[model samples]
Target: MGTISPIKESTCCDPASAGTVYLPSGTSLILLMPRLLATTIHGAVDVLKKTFDGTYDDNCPACGETHAHGGICCGIPEIHCPSPCVCSIHWVGCPGDSFKHAIQVTNTSKTEREFTLTSVPFPHTQEAVAVTPGKQTLGTEESLQAEASFTIPETFAGSKYRTVIKVKGAYEQIIQVCLTVRPRQACGCHVEQGDIPKRVKAHHWYHHFQCVEDCFEPAKKVG
Candidate 1:
């Protein structure tokens, strides 16, 4: 018998020599596919739920209403005030009562800054709203407590008043102040007797009466 030649071993190229070899085998890919698919489906479901659930920031807290995309809450314009600024303040008091609140101001910048606080009264109303510490200087990252006070006039019973307190510095801030003057005496009816329109047209009488009755029901408890 002829002697068999020694078998030559074949040499394979190194994976690094081939440049950027993907080592995952078909079985590895199959194992990973289900995990990738499940992850994608979970992300999609989350997006859909948030879109339809009205959990976005534009929903109004006061009215439980949602506005169009990028719209402000309750359709109110966005207040371009600083984070420390108090955007709104509300108070309810009987006539001749005084109310006070504290507004916090901060110097958000790196350097010292001066600020001025001014109260702008609503047109045609003599609401006695005042902001103290009208002018102040704050150091870097320092904060100040400003006072806002209002005294309801004796003649201002059963009325609503609004005033704006403005803070001017490196930037401007606005605080809306609202005062509700409670009636001294009850109207004796569920609906406020004074608010009823005396001479409504026959066709519109029902609507007018209904509106007055529904709107004034809460006022009965104020006194």
Candidate 2:
């Protein structure tokens, strides 16, 4: 083997000077953020790879450390990229008419965010549901009040339905709403009382009235 050259002595003689650095375990901590780089390198070409990946010297102020791809053995802080809004609702709607309900979406972030509202009725039911202002954009600290409406079919009964509202921006979030529909019998003689419109008479029936014998009787024939 050829004679080894004398090692250079410098102010910083740590292994890091040879192009490799050792970061103690737990020294790197990432909190409340998503990783910009899905992978990291620890080989001879680590520096070259980081430069090519465009993640060099991108230090997070929260943790005061460069990203893993930036040559710091210590863990890099999460991107902590700001979100467009803070959602206010999880499950909306209570036991009531499935035809309509109120909704609220708020944008609490410092920037603008885009959102969309959609619905999925119970597969077995014939009702069609929809959300008003389905798609919209909100600015910082802005909010929107939307309505969800259901169009009940002829044979609908008391049932529950669900709708999924998705908010997409820096990240994606899903919101769910449960809707309750009352049975047609809930009208309770509204048809006879004229409380309901004449056009809608055939669509609804009173539960008590249905159990009774037919109101009309056939006339007897004369000899």
Candidate 3:
């Protein structure tokens, strides 16, 4: 025998608002609050996961795809100088021998530039290394063919020598040189002709001789 009150309108259902929920009188607000908070937290985590997992392209800001050179961005070091800004050269020889290699350098820039070439020896005497055309001027796209040599002294005991040739111009280029000097006697093994087995297969005989040769090989230095 009591009259029911009219249901008042609730403003919490607006889309512009946050995790606000309207509850009727006598409803369990405590139970609904956790569910609302959980939903809001789950939605926020999903958004964050998607943002972090988004795929992106490797588009360089300095030089775009149009200016890429040799599969590298033009603004980087690999193609900045003359196709390759850094390189390595290796040579194997005997002691008291001189080894020479030709190095081709080009000016890839748009203007004339002068390059000064210098060598920095590593664990070796400075007199052992030499580079020709120490200084040269090149027009745009012009190339220079230079020579680098390493002379192993007769009394040198080490089997390895290294040097770095630095070319300085608008951009610096690094050339790493490694020289391996071995004794003449270390080149081959001295297996007697009578040591071969007459009944062995050709491949097996070859393998056996290779292993024997390796056993007599001298220790080589790694650069």
Give the clash total for candidate 3: 0
Cα lDDT computed for each candidate against the true fold: 0.76, 0.57, 0.71
Q: Which residue runs of candidate 3 sit more than 4 Å off their true CA positions? A: 1-85, 183-223
Q: Count the backbone clashes (under 3 Å) in each candidate.
A: 0, 0, 0
Q: Write the per-residue lDDT of candidate 1 for residues 103-141, one digit (tens) a residue.
A: 888898998999999898766866547888889999998
**lDDT pick, better of 2 and 3:** 3
Deviation from native of the Cα of residue 117 in model 3, angstroms: 1.5
lDDT over C-alpha atoms for residue 44 of model 1: 94
Better lDDT candidate (1, 3): 1
Q: Each model's TM-score, in the order given?
A: 0.45, 0.36, 0.46
How do the residues 87-144 of candidate 2 rate in per-residue lDDT, one tens digit apiece? 3332222344345667777888898988776555556754445778887898997887
Positional deviation of 153 in candidate 2, in angstroms?
2.2
Could you tell me how far off, in angstroms, the CA of residue 156 lies in candidate 2 after the best superposition? 2.1
What's the lDDT for residue 57 in model 2? 66
Q: Which candidate leads the pack in lDDT?
A: 1
* Weakest ten-residue segment in model 3 by summed lDDT: 210-219
Worst 10 residues of 2 by lDDT: 194-203
Order of quality (TM-score): 3, 1, 2
